[model samples]
Structures are given as C-alpha cells and as structure tokens.
Target: MSIRHGLLALLDQGPHYGYQLRTEFEERTGATWPLNVGQVYTTLGRLERDGLVAPAGEDGEGHVFYAITDAGRAELRDWFGTPVRRDSPPRDELAIKLAMAVTVPGVDVREVVQAQRRHSMRALQDYTRLKARALAADLSAAGPDPDGPDPDGPDRDLAWLLVLDQLIFQTEAEVRWLDHCETRLARHRPAPAAPQAPATAPQASAPAAPQAPARRRGSGSARR
Candidate 1:
C-alpha cells in the first residue's frame, strides 16, 4: 500500500493534524488497514520533506496541522487517474506457505489449504455482513428514499462502502484459490514403499535305519 499517496489524497481535502489524518484514513477505508499515530506523523514528515505538504500553523489547542502543496494535489490527481499495475504482484504469505507445504516432506498440503480456506471463508462472511450493515444504515439514514441517490455527494459512507466491497471481492478470490489448491491435492499420490525379501525355515534330518540288519545277521549266526 502507498501510504504516501494515501496521505496526499487526504491532505488534498483540507488541513489536518496527524491524529485526524489517521482517524479519517481508517474511517474512509473501513479500517481494513489501520495506521498507528507514529506512522501518521512519519508519513507527514516525509511529505513535508518532499515539498508535497507544508505546516499549516497550530490550532487553538496547540495541535500542528499540515496542508497539501500544489505538488501534492497534482500527485493525488495522477494517482486517481492511474491504474494500479498487477504485472508484478506482492509476495503473499499464504501462497508462499502453501507452495512450501506441497514441496517439503512431512507437510500436509491438503490440511494447509483447508485451514486457509476456512479462515478466508470466515473473513468473507464478515465482510459480507459489514457491507450489508453499512447499506442498511445508509438506507435508514436516507429516510424512505432508499432507492434514490444521496444528496450528500461524495462522503465517508460511500468511501467506506467502496473499500468494503473491494475487501469482499479480494477475500472471495482467495477462497477460490484455496479451493483450487485442495482439488489439486486430492489427485496427488504419495510414493510407494520398497519391497522386502521373504524369510526361509530350516529342514530336519532323517534317522538311520541300518542297525536292525546287523542285529538280525548276528542272531542268524548264533542259531547256525
């Protein structure tokens, strides 16, 4: 995520303090990516150094505010116009884990896929519920003109809805990918074990049988 561009976009609206920027960012994006106060100030400092923003004096409560420079407005406009490239996607930890699981010994790839699927499905459900709730609230606030457009123009609610919709779609895609991994794993077979040699038993010896003939010869001689 480009925190720089995000801050610039926020600054384009009006002068805001660090805490205010952070709050608005979370609110506008439906808190999908929460920013700490430190991160907010760090980004603001960078923006000032780059001449994208300037200190807009202190408020009555002694809170320092920052406003977007002309350069910042131009940058924001360009960002809004440009398409986010996907030729080189960021490294996904889950994808890396699944890939490693399938290749490494003693790792159950199916289980990994199933576990991720369950987690992703739950996230999808949550996003769906949030989207529904947001819509319902907006409808209620619309005061019986639920089907009509809002007269408030571009507002925080609209911004949040857009962000929530994106999250829902992204999570749905992840669940589908996990299901694909499981299907592939189902057809996989492990290597067979090696064969072993059979064992043999020892044979017994036969008894001698010629002793009776000698005894009979001796008896015949005595009789003669």
Candidate 2:
C-alpha cells in the first residue's frame, strides 16, 4: 500500500493536520497497517514537495494543516480510475524462500522452511480463534429478539462483518499455504542411513620365512 496515495486520498476529503490525518487513515483502513506519526509527516512533506498537496492554514495550536491541491485531486482520481493489477508481482517471503531452497544446504533450508511454516501456522491459529470470537460476538449481537427488534441495532454494523470476512479468508489461505510448504519440505528431505563402525588398520600376516632365516643364522653361528 502506498502511504503517499493513502494520505492524498484522505486529504482529498478536506484539510487536516498531520496527527488528524494519521488517526483518520488508521480508522478508515481498519488499522491494518499501522501509521507512524513520523511516516505521516514524511509523506505529507513529499506530497507538498511534489505540489500534490499544500499547507492550507494553521489550527488553534499553530499546527500547519494540509489540503490536497488540484494536482493531488487529479492524482487521486487517476489512481482510482486505474485498475490495480492483482498479478503485478509476487512479494511473498515464503515463496521467495521456497524458490531459493534448492540452493541452500538440506538441513539449513529445511530448518528455515519448517520454522516459517510453524510460525505461519501459529499465526493462522491465532487469527482463526480471534475470528471465531468476533463471529460469536457478532452473532450474539445480531440475534433476533423474541419481543422487539432494534431499529438502530447491530444489524447496521455490516462494515465489521466485511472486515472479518477479509481477515478470515487471508488467514485460511495462509494456513493452507503453510501446510503445503510443510508437506513439500518433508518430501524433499532425504531419509536417514544406518550408522557404520569406524575403519581399523589391517593386521600383518605371520612371517613364514622367519623360521628358515633363524635356522640359517644359528647354523652360521655354530659353524663360526
């Protein structure tokens, strides 16, 4: 996600201070990607430098407020008009790891892959549990009452349901991918071999000719 674009979109609504922009951005995006105060300021600075945004005025506290310029509005409109290419590129770390796994040593690669899978699985489990809880709460809140219906009730909050759906879908996909990775790693690992004993030096054979040599030496001595 482009922070610059996101901030520009937010500024298109109206002029806002840096802190307000940061807060509103988080709220609109369901706080998915956290925004640092510094990042917001930095993006604002870039937008101002590029003539996409300008300082509108100051608030009571003298903090500079920013408004999207005509150029920024055009940019935002252009962004919205353009279709995002879902197939633009793959930025998945797991995919990168698997691609390079062949070049890495067996144990080292297996360890890294397995570690990633384990972490992914754990994250999936946590997300699943959280989704379940959210669903239960949503259901309870949306449950039909025997006596009366809420005119301004939980049924109105379909926004959270949509967010939950996206979260659950992503988590389930991650879990499936992790499982596939684990299976592939297991298949690629070589089977263990039986251990062998250490090799020893060969023993020398007895000297059959030693007896003849000794006898010749003794005869020679006696003769002398």
Candidate 3:
C-alpha cells in the first residue's frame, strides 16, 4: 500500500498527468484499492518535493504532467527487487472486532464470528466470479493457446489477474479463519442447565450442604 512507490513506478513508464496515472493505476490493479484524485495529486506533490519526479510540462488542455526522475527509477527498481516484508503485520479491523467480542460482557462471540464468516464467504464468491470473467476475457483476447509460454509483451490483463488472484486467496483465508473461530468458541461455550425434577416430600433428614460457585473463565485467557 505504498502509494508513493506505486506512483513512482507508474511514472517510470513515461510522462503522465495525475488523472492519467490514477486511471492507469486503477486499471492495472483491477480497482482493488481505489485512489481518489486528491490522493494522487498529494502523492505527486510529495514525489516532486523529494526529487523523485519532475514536472514534464502541461498538455494542450492545461493539465500538469509529471515524469519520473532517475532517482525514482532507482527506487522503483529496488521496490520490484525486494520482497514485501510482513514482520509487522497491519492492524485488521475484523481481528480486533473478534477479540473485543470475546472479551466484552453480554456479547455473543459466536454471532460475531458467524456474521464475519458470511461476509467473507460472500466476498470470496465475488472474487471467484471476477476471476472467472477475467480468465474468459484474457482467453478471448489472446486468441488460441493463451497459456503458451511466448508472451506478446506488457500485458495489463495479466497484471489485473495477478492482483485479483491475490484478493481471492486472501478472502478464502479469512473465511477459513472465521470457521476456526466458530469452532473454538463452541468448544468454550457454557453448558446448558439440566431440567429439575418434580417436587418431593418436605420432611428431609439433614440440611443440604452449601455448593461452591462455578469458576468463570477470564477474558484475558480468551485468545482471539
């Protein structure tokens, strides 16, 4: 999600206006992470300030264009060469929600898990459908033997498919995680009370012994 690097990479291709870069970025990424015009301009301004990009003159219609500097190209190259590090994972809202649900009093964790599972499942289905359509479109555009090793050239279709596949896989993993949560919650769930027997005769020999309270599970002990 480094918009800076993304804009730099796009500028490496050639000179482009803010709007043009935004359009191409969305097209290549299948609009998975949409960018607003203001965001694009803000990133561009930062790039210009950092000497990563320079003004490439305006078009006939008075649109300011930008071109990547040599430094920007170097940065883009490094970005492409390096693997994305996950040592510090980003905060996920769903994970936080689930954790809070389990800890908060009077909250049904199972219901929260089920709701998330439903949403994730729906998203997975949608991504699957998009992948199917993308494959069909690629095949139709590639003519016969689309899987051949010989790539024609830079293929934006392939770029979009790769991103779409990543999204689908991520959604599938989320659904599986939600299922695991549901199972774990069920295992920890409190047992139901047993039915009482009919009333007996009043004359009891000795007083019944006092029973101890059941130990409640602590919120701190609930992992995820």
lDDT of 3 by residue, 139-216 (tens): 877675656644632388899889988998898888889888878887898645688998888886897789998777
lDDT of 2 by residue, 1-224 (tens): 88999899889878999999888777655576789899999999999999999999897899899999999999999998998788877497767877787676654665666687678677767767766776786688777789787663453334445665777687678767767766876687664577888898798987876443334445556543
> Candidate 1's residue-wise lDDT over 144-212, tens digit each?
565677664348778889989899999989988888777777667543457777766666677766564
Which portions of model 2 miss their true places by more than 4 Å?
A: 106-108, 129-164, 186-188, 193-224
Per-candidate Cα lDDT values, in order, are 0.86, 0.77, 0.87
Taking every candidate in turn, the Cα RMSD to the unseen true structure, in Å, is 7.5, 8.9, 19.8
Sequence-dependent TM-score of model 2 = 0.65
Q: Name the candidate that leads on lDDT.
A: 3
**Residue 70 in model 1: lDDT:** 95
- For model 1 the TM-score comes to 0.79
Ranking by lDDT: 3, 1, 2
Candidate 2, residue 159: the lDDT equals: 46
The predicted structure with the larger lDDT, 1 or 2, is 1
| Structural similarity to truth (TM-score) of each candidate | 0.79, 0.65, 0.80
